[model samples]
Target: ARLLKQYQTHLKKQASYIVEGNAESKRALRQHNREQIKQHPEWFPAPLKASDRRWQALAENNHFLSSDHLHNITEVAIHRLEQQLGKPYVWGGTRPDKGFDCSGLVFYAYNKILEAKLPRTANEMYHYRRATIVANNDLRRGDLLFFHIHSR
Candidate 1:
């Protein structure tokens, strides 16, 4: 229960980060475009109808997953992962029948749980757009962590 609560909080923070980051990026882009147009009227001879259309499209797709919805999904995913605790680790495996590698375990647990597909490899997961870099002190249960391991 405590872990679920921590996951819920983490989901809320992540959602807010994505939404706020996108909004700030859009604002910055608009400001930059305005300045560019002001400096070079001939370069932007026509009104920015294309830019408006792109912004409108982005706005239409900006809906974030709700905290309660994600919380329930995370709870289920955690349970699923726990059930696989004693399984053997297999490279590139993603299902219980085949066992799992580290990233494969995560891929099985959360991929498509909320209609979002996770990348197959840890390196890809680390670079995924929605993946945030949380401080070690800020980590909580259900939070996915990535690390760099040098090969000997």
Candidate 2:
């Protein structure tokens, strides 16, 4: 327990540092653009949105959000599960290499690594969380998948 807490603390601190670095990177980029604007003020259109452009460019980098603590947690969970990749498929087993149904896998994965115990069943899991539905373009690693199994 103490070791787990220490690990979580270290992860949180690293995540904070990463986020701070990302922010600094963005600030630097914006400053660079502002310098460009200052140098060529008459060449570009009026009322520039340099800030927006810098955000869009920074957002294009996948690693940009890996600094987020939530994202880091998801990444760590996925990495841990990847270590059990060749496991057999049991009807409801949650143990690694022994197989697992969908819900069982999810439950075991989160509980074992993330320390989060999600409910069982696809429908239950689908509705259990308070996540907003995001477009495919907005999906990220570890995003939940939902389907209407019985619907048209």
Candidate 3:
């Protein structure tokens, strides 16, 4: 349980870093655009609303799982992982019969319950497009975590 908690925390941190970097980049880009517009008002007729429209569309398309549903999914995954506590770690294994690797373990546990299939490897999971980065304090059961091991 402790190990699982640690993994959850690690995943939250990785996601937060990615999210923070994206927000910072967006802010920088907006500032740069503002400066360019100020210098050449004639070149820019009106402010861009494309980004806003994209965000609105994304929000409209997103489906949020209810708290109860989320909790049930988390419990199920954790239970599955706990059942394999003594299993050997295999390099690319994804099932109990063959043992399980890090990402494979996560894939097995949450993939079925989740709307989208997770990437088979940690690196890909870290960069998954649909991933949402929650605040550290908001980390809860069923959160998938990614960590850099020896720069891998």
Candidate 4:
């Protein structure tokens, strides 16, 4: 339970970082609404509403952006990955520019290029919701592939 809470907190921080470009700049549920109301008093709903309403308003105001941007983002991400193609593969190394493992390569590309905010471990990334389990024959772009190289 504690570990799950930790991951949830990390996920919230990552989302805040993505939205605000820095997690420290993100305001809490009430704070954001207060700012919005102060900025656009006529546009905001009446004050003293539920906290969830304030939180929802803040979330709805933020944009996830469009898929159109993703293609360009993905191309750029691939370019970064290609630059590391010739580097030596070390098991636990995270430095792709020098050398790193298979997992490290993906981690670097996502965090640097897209700010994808994936899990730190391969096992967690494999099971994460963003990585849908598809049949090998039905594979598509950006799909996370898994191979059973060894058994536990």
Q: What is candidate 1's CA lDDT for residue 66? A: 36
Model 4 clash pairs are none
Score residue 108 of candidate 1 by CA lDDT: 88
TM-score of 4: 0.52
Ten-residue stretch with the least lDDT total in model 4 = 60-69
Per residue, candidate 3 scores C-alpha lDDT tens digits across 1-152 of 55456545544553443212466676664455455434533222344355865443323322221244345557767887888898899999999998999888998887765545677988888897656677889887777766667884
Candidate RMSDs in Å, in order, are 11.2, 12.9, 14.2, 14.2
**TM-score ranking from best to worst?**
3, 1, 2, 4
Clashes of 3: 1
> For residues 1-152, what per-residue lDDT tens digits would candidate 4 score against the true structure?
34334444544554564344343355463466566455533232244465866565555443223243344445555666777888998887679557988878888766654434666668878776555566889875565677677867
Which sections of candidate 2 miss by over 4 Å? 1-9, 12-67, 113-116
Clashes of each: 0, 4, 1, 0
lDDT of 2 by residue, 1-152 (tens): 44446557766565444223577786775565566445534222344555776544533432323345455556666666676677777887876757877777777666555433456776777776433577999998876788877889
lDDT, each prediction = 0.66, 0.59, 0.62, 0.58
Regions of model 3 farther than 4 Å from truth: 1-64
